[model samples]
Target: MPTFNVKLPMILSLLLIFLALYVLALRGHFSYVAMRAGNYRFSKIESFNSLALNPLMSFSFALRDYQKDTLDLKPANMERLEELSKIFPLFSTTPKNDFALKNPPHIMVNLMESFGTQMLSLQEGNLNLLGELAQHFEEDFVWTRFLPCQNGTASSFFCLFFQSPIVLSKSKYKEHYLPFIPIEVYKQQGYRVIFLTAGNSTWSDLGFFMKAQGADEIIDEVALLQDYPNSSKIHFHSHYGVGDEFMYQKALELLSSAKEPLLILTLSVSNHPPYPEVPILFSKEQIPLEIFDKIPKNTSAILNTYVYANNEFARFLSKVKQSELKDKLIIAATGDHRVRGVAMDFNTEKALAYGVPFYLYVPKAYQGEIVYDKTRIGSHKDIFPTLYALTLSETRFLHLGGRNLLETQENDKFAFGFNAEVWIDNEGIYPRSSNLGYKYKDNQSLLSTEESFALDEEHLEFHKIYQEFLELQLRYKLLNLAQ
Candidate 1:
């Protein structure tokens, strides 16, 4: 008993316990671990154990698995590529000329932050979330059954430009020059590609990434401040920088002095979280009592910013419509993701949770026989393909996986969100987490999920094809990175 040294053993045991808890907490914070198991405690524990054993060991195991999968799927990748090439032709030298415009219309893509359809669809008699943007939804072509490429702002933005999901560890932007990027295609067609954002471009390496992808100019918050010294900053969460109104003003100025065919991509920031107080001209009394009850405690602030973003966008659209650029511009706008902080059951409301409106305004000159089918399912990936077909002539660009939404073919009318873990079609919505699918009815004003049901074979087949397409894209990306 004297030689046992119980105190030393107790201290060592305590230290070991502390170290174990520390490791668990540390592992829990890792993005990769959190991404895999954010909700489930058991899954998180497993992830922690795997990480604590050896952090690099997981990577090693993943690498081995990837290698094995690559070897087995190499032939399948080629086959898939060939099949996809036939579906989405690699070279479209002949412009669709449906609009028969005198000149190639200037392309303007507006990426609205947190403009979630869940909140937008809540617009009833008095509860108006869109504000000034409501009329445009009626006048322009908007696809209600739409999903974004991913849920997060940065990922959605990257996917919209790259036509593929962002690879977290080694992004294509970091590894190699992507040949099939829309910006590069626009550049090759003699269009000056400019990216404008009210937020800091360096936040997610956005400016660098855009420049790498062949954007001629990246006008971010720094440039915005320099250009418009009088512009007011949203100091509450200052990373978002100036308001959307100022950014739109800058865009207007650029449009006036354009020397060549221009493609301007504007990313708005006012609708984002930590919703700061902006000039709220709209009345809060418009919100219906029932709808107001559903939102978070900061409903007033969130709605104010939401309306502010829409009002600024509407003002920009009105100005463009009144100006000479109206006839020369092809405007496309969509939300980066659904508005966060909304409480909903994912099992029942996956479509509503991830839904975003895809609004398009093609100049009258280019509006050939385009049928604005509101029921067609689409995402950000389809935006460029539709634009390329409209504006480019005989340009050869790689079509990773997006279908031209303008195409009348019903075969490819399906929306899939790889990062959002959801797939939707005319039949039903299939979330990756469950075997049962949810049926959603798209109405004139709102899209409401009805009941949980089983997916038909056709829907299941489409989902399978989508999964294969994503896999092929990932494999292709990994191989490119390895090279």
Candidate 2:
């Protein structure tokens, strides 16, 4: 009994001392920053180096926008720090750099929800929906691997627009106008922005987030019904509003009437769960026989539905070829996330599930000027930047971890998901996370890595910093919105 009392006091005292030291260290770091202009110059590379080594500096990296010289804590930032304390005990605020395009083109981004990369086959013998889309391309398109930040439609907004990791929590409601999002920049360039979603934009606070992205007109499920009272007959309906076919038709309509230099964001709903038995736009005759052979026997409803959506998408593209906007528009297609249906035994199916496919369709006019490689490895975070680079000449994005694909970089490309991450380069796909990890030298020699092992520890450390920066950036934006 006496030993317990004595040890209890000693333990308490030791904890108090440790706490005191931690507080002192924090104060010293802040004070040092205040005393100097910058302890270290803020280059993306230099910041990454410091972030990997110093936790405190990394925390600062989250709070302080390196683009801003002053580090004074604003009221909005204070609120952000308080809220962020739950996740990051010592997080703060900062600004980031912004990039601008000289002359942006008519941009149309088609986000296919619940679509997987495996749905599209690049192999010559394979019959696939992607093959049909590739038929439209005359060596002007780039087929590459892309990773979504998370496996949800809402998180994809941040992935594509903010060029960062998904928010840590799903319930985060507030949306901020971050400089990284292309909306404001596009607006400045006199581009008329339109957002069309075939589903309820409110499904994932997507409507709210899209508005924050500066959409001049957000045509959602409600809007679709109101616009076309006979939408039921004209459009297929499931859990969402109109189907992919109707959405594409609407997109084409908008494109035809759209003023010069327009930006349209289309999020399709046909690929979501409770997959349709029939294709929305395509007849059986229109679908190639090879696509049917690719389907496995006794396939799950989800897989069947996915194939249907893929066919419908191809049909839409076929119609687009006949439209005036074919050469007038630069189309970029990607999935919101991988298909989360029942697993299949096909090669690369698992890898494709986690990392969605990304394709860029360059108009024939600018095809020569635009740069892309079939070996390109990127994440959805790179989407906006890549699109910007293609449309605008020789430009860079600020506060984005992703580089313009046309530019060369020494760092390996990686795609981070909710619980897993994939490293993609010339080495092929290397699953780096402890969970759902795989090691592969080539497509033929793939092996699962031990789940207990942490693959690419140094690289993971860098990713951690990047994620923290995104979280902090998000928190700051939300808090700023609240104020």
Candidate 3:
């Protein structure tokens, strides 16, 4: 009996140890699958970087059919990837980069829970980066604005025409906006839409999604890559997307010729890295060319390229403004998320890094001076509705989780911030301790209350919605789902 008792504990412990090892091995096999799980675990928490290390994307060369659709699996060697799977679960994206810009880098980080500007909690001050970037890109047109919510890019695009917040499956209650389709409105209002990217139409399956959202045309790299292969191999570099400037310049040509009152959302492929170095266009230097030349060709090149692109794009935009096309152009822009795995140089904090920047530039609405509150805040999802308010468009939105960028918001708070997610704003850092909770002020913070029951309830609903959205994303065959 005594021996059995002693052995029991040892046996039980051994069993547990064996079970743990087994589970770990299983996780090793399906680490990427686990990442898509959306649960709260150490794996889920730190997996953001690992995911960034390798972004699995579906990109196609323009007009190059017959080539099987391939996922851009970075850290490409399977054996090495398997080895990495043991050490650190990493994600791989297609492409890489090396380049820099004298003008400040027009960098955008599209992290789910990462925020920039150093602060960890949500506050007005944190989101000021968008406006700051806008100012940096300032030239002949207006630059600088703000919005609300980091909800997916879905609502961010639509809310551009209204003052409402567009919600994503990942958005908070007061934050989510109605997911109203706006293409009909734009078309009815006499606007031609073109959603451009460097991937096959089926990747985002954007042909259907954009048409549903009011896009009239789709210009992907598959169509434009052949136009400029010899021009420059340099790409701005983002983890996902193609490393093609042909698409960017091609889109520019199309926009340049557009009549007027045009709404364009140009999704570029260079800034996020996993890209080839592209050449700079500007003749002048705002930042420093040496920095550009020294960038690691792997991904840092995009850092340099993004800024240069931003500078040149800003210049191009200025010329676009000057063109006979139209005078009432308002560009609503923001990063989808943050850089995937910025560990060393930049502030890639889970909270800060997950947070991307946004701002508005309306040449017609140039009456307002550059509003750098250093105290105001907002998110990606809120962009669409925020802009809609300016245009006074009749389009209604649903499922958005952001608010107007131009107005003073009361109780500006967020709930259910996902992994490494930031909960901050300009007033100060509003921290949330749980997936669901009231806005966390500096004192108690939602971050601190994350373990609370209320937060759990929030998480439950949020997760439920997320799961439903995931199912829909899969069912609908949506590629990125925008969140």
The lDDT values for all models are 0.69, 0.55, 0.38
Name the candidate that leads on lDDT: 1
Once fitted onto the true fold, the runs of candidate 2 whose alpha carbons sit more than 4 angstroms away are 1-104, 120-131, 137-140, 162-175, 226-230, 233-235, 280-300, 344-350, 368-371, 393-396, 407-420, 428-432, 435-438, 441-457, 476-483
Lowest lDDT 10-mer window, candidate 1?
A: 35-44
Candidate 1 colliding pairs? 93-394, 98-368, 99-366
CA lDDT of 305 in candidate 2? 61
| Position 173, candidate 1: lDDT | 31
Candidate 2, residues 1-483, lDDT tens digits: the string is: 455446888999999999998765554333112311123321224344244335675466445533433423232355544554544333211212132243346788888887766555423443344534556544345444557766677667556655434432223233445554677756766888888877766455565567766778777755565565555553366655566766776777887887668888888887775554444333455455554465433234544466666666677677766777677678888777766543444344435546676666666664443355655656666676666655654333343355556544433433222223544443434444423234442433222222223346644454555565556665555455557
- Residue 32 error, candidate 3, Å: 27
Residue 60 in candidate 2, Cα distance off native in Å: 39
Q: How many residue pairs clash in model 2? A: 7
Clashes of each: 3, 7, 119
Candidate 3 stretches greater than 4 Å from native = 1-179, 212-214, 226-245, 279-302, 321-326, 344-350, 365-374, 393-395, 408-420, 425-483
TM-score of 2: 0.65
Q: lDDT per residue, candidate 3, 301-324, as tens digits?
A: 434444444544455455545564
Task: Find the 10 residues in a row with the least total lDDT in model 3.
Answer: 100-109
